[model samples]
Target chain A: MSTTTRMTGRRIVAIAAVALFILHQDFWFWESTALVFGFLPIGLAYHALYSILAAGLWAAAVKFAWPDHIERFAEAGEPEGGESSGGSVRS
Target chain B: MTPMVIVLCYLALLLGLGIASNRFFRGTSRDFFVASQSIGSFMLLMAVFGTTMTAFALVGSTGKAYVRGIGVYGLMASASGLIHAAVFFLIGIRLWSFGKRYGYVSQIQFFRDRFGSSRFGYFLFPILVGLVIPYLLIGVLGAGKVISPISEGRVPPWLAGLVVCAVVLVYIFAGGSRGATWANTFQTLVFMVMGVVAFSLIASKLGGLQAATQQTDPAYLSRAVQNVEIQTREGTLIREVGVPPLMFLTYFFVPLSVGMFPHLFQHWLTAKSARSFKLMVIAHPICIMIVWVPCVLIGVWATGVKEIPPLAEAEAGKVLAMMVNLLVHDEFVTGLLTAGILAAIMSSLDSQFLCLGTIFTNDIVLHVAGRERFSDRQIVWIARGFIIAIVAVTYVISLVAPKNIFDLAVWCFSGFASLFPLVFAALYWKRATVWGAYASVASAMLVWFYFFHLSEYGHEYALWGGVMPVTFCFLAGAGAMVLVSLLTRPPSPAAIEKFFPQQLEIDQ
Candidate 1:
């Protein structure tokens, strides 16, 4: 993919992840009459699945939108031992 | 052996572990507070997860699930898994960077420097301490609930509270942050294992998951609110099925409090590197699942079990302990499960106690009296003194037997959630001003007080017509922050540059 396309894709993924998180909070699915595997409450099961998806989305967020400065901080060795403030800023 | 003896032995083992951790203490205030920032990933994960679990997640959550049904898991647990990890990734990493670069040991230090006013610490110190005291009460109250019941009426609630407070104080005073981290890690493992064990034993004793769940009221299995009719001494009355949909939806904001927790902020600074956070982000949700799934299920099972009498609303907090005692039957297992629940409660208590002490000593005293006047040894002593005083105050308050553990926790978490806007803006928005910070704090607290008073007066207290109190409080804080900051002066270029150095070129 081109640089612009990749950036656009990343933005779409980030936005989608955020939207999913917000929508997951709403109880539209609470109206569902279905039960999970005939035992667990459907609402309870939905959230359990929702939680796993949330974890995956956050993983994507780390992969794509992980702040460059944080990566630099990681590469720079022990954060506590370092004193160079300017090292956190990239040109 | 009796359950009481086993519990006493468990307490003794904790004290032993606390003293053992002291051998690694380096005798510096830095080592005392942040453990010299040498904590690795697994320890960091365990410590952070343990501190967040608290009695709120174990005792309070199980009780809440009993009252509210399966919907209880969705209200906080499931959402928390994601929201907490997001907070860790977004807020925690940035704060860790700032803390490392600027040598900040507490949240108040960051706010003081960011707002360009040392006086801001004065305004913040008491508010943060007041908020934390309620959070501390959750643990103390929970410890009392777990211990008092298992030991029967022989041990009063106040005695249980005293034992928990004294045990935590000994470890924290001796080993400081390092000791708390080690204890929290050990406690986290103990509680997670015991939680699953208790769930399995109880479920089997109640004739397996399918049969147990089948025994519960059908309305209890659904999110759709229904009028559950029950026959009581006062005659038949109706109870609501589960949490209202809107209230359940708005609970997503409560976990956002993790961003502004002074205790968690201190934990963030203990990371050896930003890389240390990677494990926390990935594993936090998974770990939350491990702990909460069993608690919620067991709580749901309690509704169906016929062995114990139906729990009155007021007696909901004892559901978990009652389940273990009635179902397990063995003194050893019951004592072990009680210890595990207490482990979860004490893990958070030690951290909160240590954080309050660190804040009082570093933010209030050292900042006001001047650090040069106090010796390093004196500083540690000052922190220890404040912790002891706070523990005494919390223990005394727990004796009064105030609000339900879960209800009190929601109010406490709400206060922290309302303040989330202040910290987020301070870090991410250059236009964020000291005036805006002031306005945000004032607005959030005022709204919180109004709702709190309404709750006391028996009002449902939803804001903006059925929206949760946290929604309005967060908006009031964020809205005041943005509008007041724009109308007022932006932070100085120098102040902005400190936080956002790369933006200096763009601004120029």
Candidate 2:
């Protein structure tokens, strides 16, 4: 089994996302009048699938490219002090 | 009559929930603004997603689809899904950490601290508020457009806008961000579920899904070109093409606006943990799919429905309401769906209202006026007062405003998208200086207004050949930032060290 480095994994996801953006144009489907499931227009069907794919890509990005360093930085900071709750919530 | 009754009840219920949520208010300026950073994954998903999905999704997209065809989804939802999440991952998370580390409540605060310029707020604040006013108006206007038809015009559009603004104001006034999150979570569910139900009900009324789509003109189903002359900044050319490839391609930049939305910035800060963003990011595209597919389909389907007839130029925004009222015969269901659509609109409204108030209180009143002058309680009151004023102003403006929800949203989104460069550079580019940031914003607005003026603010305006004004505005901002930053001194190393945690880690 091969292990993926963080940078390589991020690059792969980034490239894939860019690829998806290009694919989003869907020129092939744009002029096609065909319907998916006999109800969905080809352009609409293509975009629906594309949106789901984009969601999947984001999930992958989150898993692989999560900025762990920022979390560490925020955590290392001293806790916030003196939260005041006396103010009114109304005008 | 029954539908009207139900919608009234639903509004009353929402107001009731706002009062209930206020009981749990932590009663602090921070809690009022960002819910004291206590929102979890699901609620964070709901609030952020709900805020992003405004009248633009339901009313605006439907109207756009009615005119432009199903390509509206391709231009908007699919693109937003990819770009918005990327923004959240890169910009949102990093800023959230900065916010938590420094007790930064507003985006302006982060910008001021990052660029080491207090005067930056004077320029950025007005731009933000101006852009956000259109966004806020979108919700109020959408609710008015939809509600009147649902009630058979028994309730006037003015009254509808007034009721929505007032309800959102009351809730936000009491519950603040926490109430907004709770309301948004509830409304998000209402709209998503009801959206599917409305989709099915409408399609069934037209025979079936296939039959309903068949009712649409084929030209309205495809993204093929149409011959239409458009006014551009250069001058009007007798060119004959609509939704050209360049225009379609450039539409991608428009969704990048979410990266810079003030309301969205405030919502990002409300997350309880960094991990909470995962659900919102991953699920956002799919959630967009759920809402947009139906609304766009319904809009296109309205073309063939005899019940809907034809709409005048100004009547486009009312298409969604017309369809729901005419097709779905169940009075109870219509009322429920009206609440659902209002749910979609109001969710964004409350957040925008609260965000602007937070900005006014934090950026101008506290930072500019000097914090020592006002008591903490007074500061809270000022936030509440500002929110009321905004809601009031928005409601008044909505009355005479243009009814083209789609065009209004595009222009608003374009302004924010144009500013995305400054935000991106501020976060990642250590060389980004205060002067460069100012140039970026100024260049963006100048270019944006230039195109807008040439178009006469027309709905169908385009640039050089077919690209939207946003494409040029975004480029100008990016170009100016790069050019001006190179010409100017780089940000101080101490400022870079403050914003760039990796550097701080290395130093330690």
Candidate 3:
């Protein structure tokens, strides 16, 4: 992932998340008595698909929005002058 | 008899898993409370997701869907899918980083350190435990209600509640949260698979999913509440009712409560690496869909099923169990479905029992008595004793628990959602102060109680003009935190440097 693409992906995912939230209300389907696949209500089906999109968006968040700096802090061991590692025995 | 045996076996398996996991226990408070921080991505997802779900996901959602229609899914599941992940990504990772960095065991520790006030822990501890007791009752009471009907009354609700509590305590006592996570992982998988199987068999029995749904009134299937005018003896009136749009929109805040759940914070700390959060962040929404869509659908379908009895307002929680019993008559499958329901309930119970114990031992007992006074072994014992006491108290209350599981859960969740603002600001806003946090909590509690006192819990309760109390409680909390934080002197720079370092983009 190039830096520009990574940044763009993050922006796109954020926009998509906001769109998903807005679409979630589904007021149009609120009164419609339609069924999809003859088994699921149109409203219910819309939300199920919305849930999948959300999962995808969160995956995008992990890929793009993950804070490597914070991870580096942990991997780099305790910072100098940090409090004495509290009272814990890490395996 | 067969179904009852299966439920017993299910409980036994959980107990066995916990006892077996205890063999790996390191005999230290760290290991007992947080699995020595060794959990990886898959187990982290299971534990976090499992704890987030409770009787609320299965029995309560099903029950609520029965009364409220398919909108129940919209009101909670879909919004929860988005909001919960947002919180996990935005808050969970940051908290995990802080917990690992500071070796913090409980949420109170993080808040206490962030605000530089030990008094905050004392304030926050009782509220967290107070709210969690109702959460625990949701499971215990849900279990009692769930098991009796599914087993044809061979096992009464009180006995079922006892067995469920006993089993959870046994596993929690032996395994601590580490054991609880392992058991949660197993139980989570069990419930998910069982949820699908039950949904399939019951739908197959009731003609088909679409056919079962279409059999009900269109009004039941519709999520819209529209205006209808009527004439009375004295006057004419217009009414707009069903599911209020404002109520639906405000429900979006209820799931935000997860960001502040103490048990979830404990699970977050268990992550072995920051990367472990990646899988959890991705899979949680999909997992929620898999569990909720069917349960809600089954609940709606129960309305059309001819064999099922009419569930009164108070008897709503029993609707799911009644469907399983009346429709899936094969004893063996009923047993499995019952185990699945119990799985969802108990997975959450073990974690809650373990978490409350963690809070009492680490936050209250040790902080006040001084860690210097007790050995690590003694601390673990103190935790165990306190956990057993809480479990007994929660179970006794479950005996006379209210009729509607969903309503009870909503009230409990509203209380936690009130604290969501305080935790959010503490993590993200460096300016948040100790006194600001105090005001935020005070206002949040006052507003939450103001609304709660107004509610009879007799009908589905909402605030002015059909909005949920959570929306107001959350606002009051956030408004107070930001206003007071600005007015008060800012946090010590040292606190800022500790929580935020080098302008990390995530923090920014």
Candidate 1 docking: what grade?
acceptable
Find the candidate with the highest DockQ and give its number: 3
Better model by lDDT: candidate 1 vs candidate 3: 3
User: Which 10 consecutive positions of candidate 3 chain B have the poorest summed lDDT?
Assistant: B226-235
Clashing pairs in 3: A39-B210
Give the per-residue lDDT of model 3 (tens digit) for B282-301: 99999999999999889878
Can you write out model 2's per-residue Cα lDDT over B1-508, one digit (the tens) per residue? 8778888887888898899989988777778888888899899888888999886677778877877778888888888888888888888888888777777778887788888887787779999998888778778877877788777788898998898888888889999989899899999998899889888888888999999988877777788876434333456634332257887898899989988998998898888878888998899899999999999999888877877756643566678777877887678888888888899999999998998998888887777566657776687789999999888888888887776644666788899999999999998788888889999999999999988888777366776667888888999999999999999999878877777756334222
Query: What DockQ does model 1 achieve?
Result: 0.28
Q: Give fnat, all candidates.
A: 0.32, 0.54, 0.48
Write one digit per residue (lDDT tens) for candidate 1, span B189-288. 9888988898889889878777767776666776777777765566775777677767877878899999999999999988888878888887888788
Worst 10 residues of 3 chain A by lDDT: A82-91
Residue ranges of candidate 3 with Cα displaced over 4 Å: A1-6, A78-91, B150-154, B226-242, B400-406, B457-459, B503-508
Model-by-model DockQ, in order: 0.28, 0.39, 0.40
Score every model by TM-score: 0.92, 0.92, 0.93
Candidate order (DockQ): 3, 2, 1
Candidate 2: misplaced stretches above 4 Å? A1-4, A78-91, B227-242, B400-406, B503-508
Best of the two (1, 3) by TM-score: 3
DockQ for candidate 3: 0.40
